[model samples]
Target: MLRRLALATLATTAAGLGPLPPLPLLAPAGPDTLTVTIAESGHPDADGTFELSCGDKAGGNHPARDKACERLERLAGAAEDPFRPVPEGQPCTQVYGGPAVAQVTGTWRGRSVDARFSRADGCEIARWENLEPVLPLVRG
Candidate 1:
């Protein structure tokens, strides 16, 4: 199933369409990849943009390629979307994590994703932690 998405073949099968008219590969990493960017206000060295590919073999410029790739694969198959933002109006602690922020944009499990992450509050902190190595680990 994962490979199918990389090949851009799952859209047809998963959607009951006999065949998709060939989706143009989104980038050189193919359609099964994500781009992660992290930044810390006033901390230039702490920012970076990485590419992660979880297809035939784990390959990319991410600092933790293997772990990040595996984490994404697991999240892709999980019942809940790991990229989902915390529910609105949900109670969260007032704790302030830090100035770090991140974004993950690309395709995953055959779906498009453009999730933003931060450590501004409890819920945001938890949300940032969910993607683990995909984003940088936050020390609290």
Candidate 2:
């Protein structure tokens, strides 16, 4: 009965007609999700993970998801690199602002971001500062 009906359906499908369509995939729990982490080099207490989401509705563990998303959107649109590399042979002041490191992973505006940021030198410090509010500048 049931078994025969099942076999008949399977046979019909395999006979010549196209196979059944695949099931629809479920939407993600949230769009534009990001996992952000910041740590002060050598300081374990300052490290923590923040989950964020941005889109028509912005929300997540991040304290300022809306602002963070706004900054990220701006960064994505900027002609200059938000995390521009320091040009070779260009001398920068020997300034060690503080060894703060940040990691941003996940999707933003439907694009992946697996960027690490650090303030090891003047150029790096400038890059980190540009990402501020999104990745807060750590002071020693």
Candidate 3:
């Protein structure tokens, strides 16, 4: 059954039919400290920037924890939109956040899309999403 489904998907793609369900575009909102932008194409991609202020104290107890807290606090102040891409006949999950990066994943119209973001400087960052195994499906 799985093989048949795959074959069907391939055939549809070859015929230039539309891909599976499309991912929705979500906007970011909240405190002005954080900003998020999402771009839709054959694959969906997003970019986010976080602005934060380091404490006045030069150094103190729990420096590591303090830094982590600062990072988390910046993330908390930022806004995130729930937008992702969907590939045809494929299911996927999107995971965001790492030591200092954010990521997104999913199947979009029979193609796999991944996006990543990182802090570019002290107050700004950017990210881009890429689609793989390009299919012949038109964006709706």
**Best-fitting candidate, scored by TM-score:** 1
Ranking according to TM-score, highest score first: 1, 2, 3
* TM-scores, one per candidate: 0.72, 0.63, 0.18
Per-model tally of clashing residue pairs: 0, 0, 9
User: lDDT score, residue 49, model 2?
Assistant: 85
Q: Candidate 2 has what TM-score?
A: 0.63
Q: Each prediction's Cα lDDT score? A: 0.80, 0.73, 0.33
Model 2: ten consecutive residues of lowest lDDT? 21-30
Which residues of candidate 3, in runs, are more than 4 Å off? 1-99, 122-124, 128-140
lDDT by residue for model 3 (1-140), tens: 76877787788888999455544664233221212222222333222322222233212222233453344345435642222423355533334222244443442222333544333332212222221101111122
By summed lDDT, the worst window of 10 consecutive residues in model 1 runs over: 22-31
Tell me model 3's lDDT, rounded to 2 decimals.
0.33
CA RMSD, predictions in order:
8.6, 10.4, 20.1
* lDDT by residue (tens digit), candidate 2, 1-140: 76876676688788977455555664355477888898865556447788888777778888777888788778767744454456788787778878678888887655467887887778778877787667764764
Model 2: residues with Cα > 4 Å off, grouped in runs: 1-30, 41-46, 79-91
Task: Give a tens-digit lDDT track for model 1, residues 2-55.
Answer: 586655666666778666665665434444688989988345644789888888
Clashes of 2: 0
